[model samples]
Target: MENQEQKKRDTNKIYFLIAVIVALLGTNMYLYFQKNKSDQRIVTVSDEKTALQTELEKLETELDQANNSTTELSTELKTKDDELKAKIAQLKTALNKGTLTAGELAKAKEDVKQLRYFVGKYTADIDDLMKKNAALTGERDSLKTTVSNVKQLADNLSKVNDSLYTKVKAGAALKTSQIQIGAFKIRNSGKETDVTRASTAQKIKVMFTVANNPIAEKGSHDIYMRVLDPAGNLIIGEGGSFTANDQDLQYTYKTAIEFNGDAKTFTLDWTNRNNFEIGTYSVILYADGYTMGRGSFSLR
Candidate 1:
């Protein structure tokens, strides 16, 4: 009986040892599976992070490209705006002058249309540019109107000749005795006649014969005489007669003589208040405010 009991106890001990070994192996297997699962989760998270970083880099590149394109487009638009403004100015100048033909007007209108289209197409925030363009358009239109009015005035003046009614006849050839420095044709008529120097009281005589010129109209034309000293200074005072061809019209000078289709001699006497200088004096004759003829005489 004692031997059987001892064998039973040894069998129980062997069974217990086998069970402990199996439990330790199972624990090790479970720990290995858990560590593998943690490592796989870490690898998946790393792969997801790499994909997100690549997507962000692509987005940034696209944004940079978009900004560059915007800048280039803005620059191009500004250049186009400047070109359009210059074209508009030229067009306005041509249009208002009335000198532009039909074809040119049509072309300018088309250009203006094109400019308007371009301005309308601007997508950027260009309020200042739009305002400037509007101002330029207004200025161009104003200048066009002004030039058009000037052209009309010039055209009207081209149709009529107003200078014909103011015409006058030519005068006669002047004579030497008419410009004599002393009394009329008499030796020592007043004093010794000195062409070089004369007292302020001496009288100078002038004579001229009118010539039959077709330019001399039959109207009663006024005559003007301008006397000049040697230095070309006017000897006449400023308060001379201001009458011309017709008594109705008052000009710088006047003389009423009927032109009877013949030449006539006229004599004029100038009494001097200032001493005559030793030089040539010039006399200019005018009819109806038109210079008819000129004559000169030496005093010295």
Candidate 2:
């Protein structure tokens, strides 16, 4: 009986040893599996964080590029840009943490997705603004060109009118022709006789016919006469001054004639206070700021 009891006790010890070994193996296996799952979670979180960080940086770069465009942003657009930048900054701060819980990571993912949508909308808004600006610029340029063309056309018309006025003014002047000069002597009885001798001459007579010009000014027209001696010196008679060919000139005689737009002949007489010279004399007539006609007579 002692030998049998001892064998049974040895068998119970082996079975307990086997159960303990099996329990230890099961506990170790469970610990190993749990550790492996934790490592994978950590790696996944790290990779996700890195990807989010990369995306945030890319969004920031795009924002900066949009700001660098040539078009100036409106006040509202600038505010939106600032808000987006702040959002990026906030996201970056969140992603910079060393560790993230699953809930936090999932929240970050949602935020990033929303950020992408907002960024796409922002870019679309910028494109629309740029297109509008381009169209406005084109319209402004076209308006300027139209204004310039109109101004040029007005200037051209003004020049043409001025030219026509100048021509019309020039065409309205009166013309004189058939000028004749005669010398005469007045006897003591007050009778006149034609004479050629300078010493015997006491009066000078001038005759001319005016052309019919309907455009010329009607009414009484003042006529001025200038007499030049053989030496080319002007003979001062009345010492009256008149303007002719843009020059102030002294006249020897002046008279008035009535003009009614009909061809007419007129005569004038002048008695010199000084003695006449024995040479050729030149007589020029002026009317309305123009030289009318010239004539010559000899005196002896």
Question: Which has the greatest lDDT?
Answer: 2
- Model 1 per-residue lDDT tens digits across residues 1-300: 999999999999999999999999999999999999989966765554454334334433433343344233358666755665565556555545624445654565566556556544543335445566678889999999999998998877754434433221213322122222232222554543434343332556656666655444565655666777789777764346654334332222234566654667666566655566777777766655445566776654
**Residue clash pairs of candidate 2:** 198-300
- Model 2 residue runs over 4 Å out of place are 1-30, 183-187, 192-203, 228-253, 270-282, 296-300
The lDDT of model 2 is: 0.90
Candidate 2 lDDT over 29-60, as tens digits, reads: 99999999999988888999999999999999
TM-score of each: 0.36, 0.79
Estimate the TM-score for candidate 2. Answer: 0.79
RMSD of each: 20.2, 3.5
lDDT (C-alpha) at residue 234 in model 2: 96
Candidate 1 Cα errors over 4 Å, as ranges? 1-158, 163-201, 214-219, 241-255
Give candidate 1's root-mean-square deviation (CA, Å): 20.2
Instruction: Write down the lDDT of every candidate, Cα atoms only.
Output: 0.56, 0.90
